[model samples]
Target: MLDKTSPSLPRGMRYENQLAMIEGMSLADIAREYPTPFYCYSQSAIEQKMQACLKAFEPTGAKVHFAVKANSNINLLRLMAKAGLGADIVSGGELTRACTAGIAPADVIFSGVAKTDNELEYAMHKGVGQYNVESIEELHRINTIAQRLGVVIDAVLRVNPEVDAGTHQHITTAKKGSKFGIAYSQLDSALQTAATLSSINVRGLAMHIGSQITSLEPYSQSIQRMLHWLEQLQAKGFAIDRIDLGGGLGVDYGNGEYLEYSDYAELIQASFANYQVDIQLELGRSLIAEAGILVSSVVSTKQSSPNNFVLLDAGMNDLLRPSLYQAHHPLLAASLSTSARPETFDVVGPICESTDCFHKNYPMLRPNTGDLMFFTVVGAYCSVLSSSYNSRTLIPELLVNGENVRVIRKAWTIDEQLKLEE
Candidate 1:
């Protein structure tokens, strides 16, 4: 089952003679020990990516807060916390995870458009750092909850700057028609109303244009917009202390290419050069996406009409980005013959639906039954979005540090999952 280095692999992911190693350990060995249809992450890769991000934003004095929704595994959170990164959470569960992972409550920022009253109450009780208030009603709700708890809650109004982040339409949050943040047109009235809230400390401003953004122009525009509003609010006697530029830096899913953190930091520092405010970044994907891979075993290969199909044991239940967002995650055979020729494959999952397909007419090394296939750049949304669709139990998550591999999240059995309601 050994293979040679093929041109199909990404830069970081390569075949060392006959073994596919991520960081230092053999991916095939990990897959065999943990079984197929599992997610594996590289500790060094995640740390390197995180450090790069922090270094980039150091000039602007921006605090790095890892978005919990991206990869909420407590172990990953613990790693992030140990690296001096905070948490940007959207739910009570995520908030609890952040706390349990040893992240300080003062380092947690609660963010969500439709946060429930219970969630607000819990956030206030936990004394989370900031609430990215999305709507006027939500603002009032947080204020009321904080007042009930007899504590002052710090918050930032998430304004919808209506700028197109030039990303996927579904992920575009700050667009004119998006339901994410408060309308920019009514920001003035919203701020006035917010300032009147007794238990709410309107500390600053926040804006997230969109996700998977490659260019820095949208961010520059969004920052300028927020700064202009900040100046306007300050002129009206409001003291803004922070500006949270929500994180959505995209990764190179197709290839090993991405805007360097240094370059991104330069852009951010240049944009905020004349201003001084506590800058906060909530980066999620860019820091973790490329650090992980999904390894699945090919169940069978069949010749379909006008195409060859390679079916995997891992389906949409394991990784949903392909079906959900038509995302492109690079795929390669874990073992490849030096003389094997490249062939176009319709790589698909075991799901019964047509959307379960991972790639269509994609060219890669030919795969055979029981052969391992490594899906790259899936460290972010893949595992978090997994489910028990078709009653397939959730898979395990392995963390690789040097030559060590630890199962961070154990795979669930169907019976164990059924025990939930029992």
Candidate 2:
């Protein structure tokens, strides 16, 4: 029997008759219909999480935008749109995807550090609601694009407050010397320049400290700094009306520790109660990470001197967080009926690179060849980061709504990939 009390498992995932089940369907059944090494998302889980997030931030009158970089699948984006969430996009393709997903262009906020001139013009043409300007150069570029289009554009200056997010360094974005946002010291001059731009309306300030942030202290510190600048800009006669608190809220990935949305909402209310400006949020992982899992079939198991290895069909190309960020995802066997004893395994993928290992020295029930296994809390970055490296075909993704399942993305075949080549 699966341990129902274990926090590592995704919500709504449990065991029935010693078989792993998602929602009301058995994983073995799903794997039989759809191939293994595919991603499966629970519709009910995502909807519940979204509703909770919306409720938590409702008191702040915040406009929540789902960061499209997390999981750009159009089906999921459509679900977010249906839930009344806007799109926080960073590329023209993402903007198109959001629009195609039925999110209004007025609800899109284009955010990135290196948007090209063509991208700026395209966003303007598509009527993107706001632009989070990373540098004075980008601000000038927006002004130029707006001038060429003969339309005024709404924009906000993204400031780096030099606050430590206390998360992984690779995901930390807003500290000093980071290439993400404008330097705090240069905000004054940036605003002065924006004041001279006739086609651009710099309405507010934006700041994103980092991703997977567990502590509220960093957010508190970053908000304090942003408010300081907001007050300074207002004092200087700038009509500052918005504060984009770019999202870095973390979710629990088997650690049983994460930032609560209620606490974050309380902090926002307490901090901005005196101010009358609009609040905007760009949330990504926290909303969807715990709603999906990657189900893979065990290919083989072997002992190599000091380490026991269990190989699966999925690789770093399919889920790169382990190799790229050293992220940990709880692995569980589909069936707990194995006669072999539980063992410590270095779960690995069939990739050519040495960095394709998922977990090291992990304790789990011994899985036999052809048995099903899954990695939890992978809904956000797993599918979006997949690559067709080493001639491996991209896997399919399925969304489950109770007993009904739908393939949201079709698997890429080797023939299709070869067709693109000579």
Candidate 3:
């Protein structure tokens, strides 16, 4: 189905102000047909986001490698591949999923700190675009695998420039002491081994500072430092053909003003203009977050101590951001009424864990039990990270295209879950 007008998501669906289409169908209608807890996607929103990203980075000669870990649903992957995007993978599973999605093996680039020998061997057999080596040991591993496979492997040294991305500490990587990439002090030994290892061709550099990075200064600093390193490599007669910057572009959960695609691309392009090298970027959250939202029904509500609790049918088992990162997702009542007085409610889920709360200071207009709720900005990490904890059935995923909607992932059946039980 093709979307005509832009989508206007219900509040808490993401960046509150964007127009929400609900796929030209009502959220209540979708819930009634599919069941209480399910996932809904906006075809137009995803396409628009990709368009914006392409427009922003087109001037920089950059290729967008959709981070497969962000959302590995095969249907979503197929849509992205059709859009001419490449894949940025970190594991054998992601690489397999990308290939299953019809992404060319040569278009895939692997990035991670600890790739096992088997993962490297699998990637080499697939003739993946490059192996982003994080340490000298990894380089040796790649060479070892390539030698056994009788194929040359291309590699990019993932360097730690020590730039702070000002995001959450758990996700922060490129910091000097972080366990992500090689320290600057180890580069000489790495390059020395790389030059001698005929099985591995070290052709590029890669860096991923952190996740949810909304600032430009950190990126600019990282790019400048990387370029200087590349220049040094060129001075040493090592052929460096590209720079793969791992993507951590943050989506506007509340503040779209903080993340602007144009400004971010402009900062990177201006700095890299001196060099005529190919560039690739791997992005996940920023591309898919707004296009998807979770629909859940408020099962009941009660007064607890000094606060009102709105219990939802979905929980951290369905969406783990709250439990994992202490992340706050916006929540909105689908059947909103202007006349009803708004109230502050702690939006929670049925999971037994006390930490299974979506938002503690959640704002709500008057809402009743059985009212549908929308959890915005969940397109990236939500569904892919869901679990069967408490034996909860997996949420059904629906694809909405204009007035046409179809179920891509049917809700998990009890029998299906039991099939795996011993």
TM-score of every candidate relative to the true structure = 0.96, 0.98, 0.94
lDDT ranking from best candidate downward: 2, 1, 3
Residue 73, candidate 2: alpha-carbon lDDT: 96
Candidate 2 displacement at residue 185 in angstroms: 0.9
Error of 2 at 149 (Å): 0.9
* Highest TM-score against the true fold, candidate: 2
Distance from true location, Cα of 382 in model 1, Å:
0.8
Per-residue error (Å), model 1, residue 187: 0.9
Candidate 2 TM-score, C-alpha based: 0.98
Give per-residue CA lDDT, model 1, range 243-319, as digits (tens).
Answer: 89999887777654455667778877887787768889898988888888899999998897899999999998899
Worst 10 residues of 3 by lDDT: 10-19
Candidate 1 colliding pairs, count: 0
Model 2 ranges with Cα > 4 A deviation: 1-6, 338-340
Candidate 2 displacement at residue 111 in angstroms: 0.2
Distance (Å) between predicted and true CA of 290, model 2?
Answer: 0.4
